[model samples]
Target: MATTTTTRSFLQAVATEEVATPLRVVQMEGLVILKIIKHCKDHSPSLVTGQLLGLDVGSVLEVTNCFPFPMREDDEEIEADGANYQLEMMRCLREVNVDNNTVGWYQSTLLGSYQTVELIETFMNYQENIRRCVCIIYDPSRADQGVLALKALKLSDSFMELYRSNNFTGEKLREKNLSWVDIFEEIPIKVSNSALISAFMTELEPDTPVTQCDYDRLQLSTSSLMERNMEFLIECMDDLSLEQQKFQFHYRSLSRQQAQQQAWLQKRRAENMSRRAAGEEPLPEEDPANPIFKPLPEPSRLESFLITNQISNYCNQINGVAGQSFNRLYLMKALHEE
Candidate 1:
């Protein structure tokens, strides 16, 4: 009875606590970062996801640990097994006195191709249980270019509200002041290490000024990355054009319906005038059963917005990689001349 009462009190405290604190930073442990990197790199080119465990502090999410989910087929029974596995893992961690609270999940992306409707749906699912959550995206392919290529992202508040309502019409989007770029907000990642680990890393530091990582930064091979980005960008542009065609078709149909309705109304008015002139009761000006009077549904703009966002992301990636590649080539040229 006492244990039950304590559990109830704890639940009440958590329920009453404010969950609207906007997350400003993601403080991740160095060990957790290494684990994520290893898990992602181990299955490169094949996407993988893992759950993050952490504590939610004021304006900061401290990610202390994480565990990878086993890859399984998409079946009902398999899904159930996956859920059971997650619960078992959490229970085991709790036994070991570890922070087992689910903060979010991390996933591997190929060349930064992580923006999609599926990702948005995943965010929505996580947000349902956790008041605030973030997806840590690691692009293993991009990391080859000497960049960490890891980022934390969450759906913007306005975007989430609009998504929940399932309304992405032009008027609603304008009212919310949400554009394609406003869909996802990226939070800065701060790596934290314990004193012992910090000291260990300091001892491991090399005496040489130039390291292999510096050599990687100067590598002038970015053609493949740029090619892939351009290909994806072109595909997105085609998709955007198709979405525009859908809106065009809808508008055309709407205009034709309006024209038909106007003609029918004029004909009814003329008939009513003749009946009145003949000293008879005129018919009603409006007919509820008329097919032309039915309102046409507007096409949803959500898909188009996402496609545009993806295109912008691809463009930015290409731009950054190309700029770096050019600088590297110039440095190489100067070194050869010297």
Candidate 2:
């Protein structure tokens, strides 16, 4: 009871702190970093997710260890087994006096498709259980292009509340002023290494001479990335258009049904009035129209917003890759003229 009280008090204090100060820093150990990279590379094109073990000191989360969960088609079964495995692993870690608490989990993404429902569900689960949990995203595809992209993300307070309420209604979203950007906040990550480890790494370095023209990074090797991003963007646009068409169709159908209902009601009332004027019994004054056309349920706008955000991401990536290719072309032209 005392421990529970202490934890609650600590959490309350954290909640009272300025929302801008969430996740001040993420300190990742070298071994943990290597393990995550290796796991992601081994999976290659397939998406993989894993659990992280760490300690939270003040606002900084220190990740000391991690383990990858195998890729499986049965997500529901895998989730159950994953939870059991985490529990067992934490138990063993505690026996060895290692940090056993789960700070967050990591997922591998292809391009930027990690902005999907499954990923959001996982983040929500973690945040509900662990107040300061973060989702670390590792993009192996981008890494293969000479850019190692790892980002730490957590849901903002307003987004979290919106998710908890399970109400994705338009009115609620607008009232909260919530947008795609407000859904998640990226936290800065700092890799930490010890002096002994640094010394060992330095000793392991090759003694070969290095040249200054090591421009491998500037090579126009983004053809695959550019093609994929363009394809994905086009597909997303088609999906967005389809959703809009469905919404418009629903609105037109609703308006027509409403007009028919009004006509039916007016006709019934006029008939009853003529019967009464002729000293005949009038029909009951209850509604006589069918309830089948009562407005169809509103389609959730969550999917539309997600597709828009994804389209935006693809555009940004294409622009960046195109810029790099143009720079390389300009360099080649200058060299040829010279």
Candidate 3:
């Protein structure tokens, strides 16, 4: 009886702790960051994912280590093998005294295109097992422009609740006060290193004031990235327009149905009056068999919200890159004059 009571108390305490402390920040080890960068860069253009191992303490999710998921076909057998591979890798890491707790997963994105239905579905799948988890997105393509394009994102609580209900009607969205921007909440990432590792990095630093990386940062060739962003932005706009058309079509059909129902009701009431004048039983005003009286289904706005979010992200990226390019061009012009 004592042991059972202790176990129950412990479980209750854990549940209360989780509910009280929501994830606010992601603390990633410097070595883990480097490993993620290496894995993503090594598979540039071809997207890849890796599982993060870490400790979840208080409001901070600490990512200490990560291992890449092997590339495999989409077949069920291959996916089953992938699952076994992950189990084996985690077992080995545990044996080596590493932090093997699955905090979250990281994936490489192409040109900042990580917002999608598939990503949401993946988050839902992870949420089934983990109470709260984040996806660390590394954009290798954007990194080429001298930017560390790493983002840690999680689905917003309200959005997740709405998503789980599978109801994205305008009314439901309004009730939740959820917009496209609320879909993903980005948690700030803090990279940390142990004392020994920090000392080692300090010693390895070169004496030069300027390096190859600094030169690469000043490169003015951003036309390709800009063009690609514009192309994607246009595609998203088209998709958004399509979604709007669907809503418009739905509204039109609804209006027509309403009009038909009104006309039928009026006609039925007139017949009822004639039957009353003849001292006969009045007919019913509503027709349960009529399809026009049935309510029209509203179109889900989830797709439109996602497209809008993607468009906003693309615009912000383009603006940042353009601003940097302009600064570089002006600096080059001043240098040439000198």
User: Which is the leading candidate under lDDT?
Assistant: 3
Query: Which candidate gets the maximum TM-score versus the true structure?
Result: 3
Q: How well is each residue in 80-155 modelled by candidate 3, as lDDT tens digits?
A: 9999999999999999999978988999998888889999999999989987788999999988777888899999
Candidate 3: count the clashes: 0
- Candidate 3 ranges beyond 4 A from true positions: 1-18
Model 3, global lDDT: 0.91
**C-alpha lDDT score of every prediction, in listed order:** 0.91, 0.81, 0.91
Worst-scoring 10-residue span by lDDT in model 2: 209-218
Model 2, 1-338: lDDT tens digits are: 99999999999988877463456889888878888989999998898888898988877998888888777556898879977876887788789887788899988888877777777788887777887888888988877555667888877789778877777767788999998767767889989887898999889876765522234456667788888988999999999999899789878987887787778778878999999999999886556456744556767767777788788878888887788789889988999899
Residue-level lDDT for 181 in candidate 2:
69
* lDDT of predicted model 2: 0.81
Error of 2 at 319 (Å): 1.9
Candidate 2 wrongly placed segments (more than 4 Å): 1-21, 73-81, 207-216, 264-293
Per-residue alpha-carbon lDDT of model 1 for 1-338, expressed as tens digits?
Answer: 99999999999889867456789999999988898999999998799999999999989999999999988578999999999999999999999988979999999998777888999999999999998799999998888788888899999998999999999888898898888889999999999999999999899999999988787787777788788888988988999999999999999999999899889999999999999999999999888898888888889998998888888888889889988988988888999999
lDDT, ranked from best to worst: 3, 1, 2
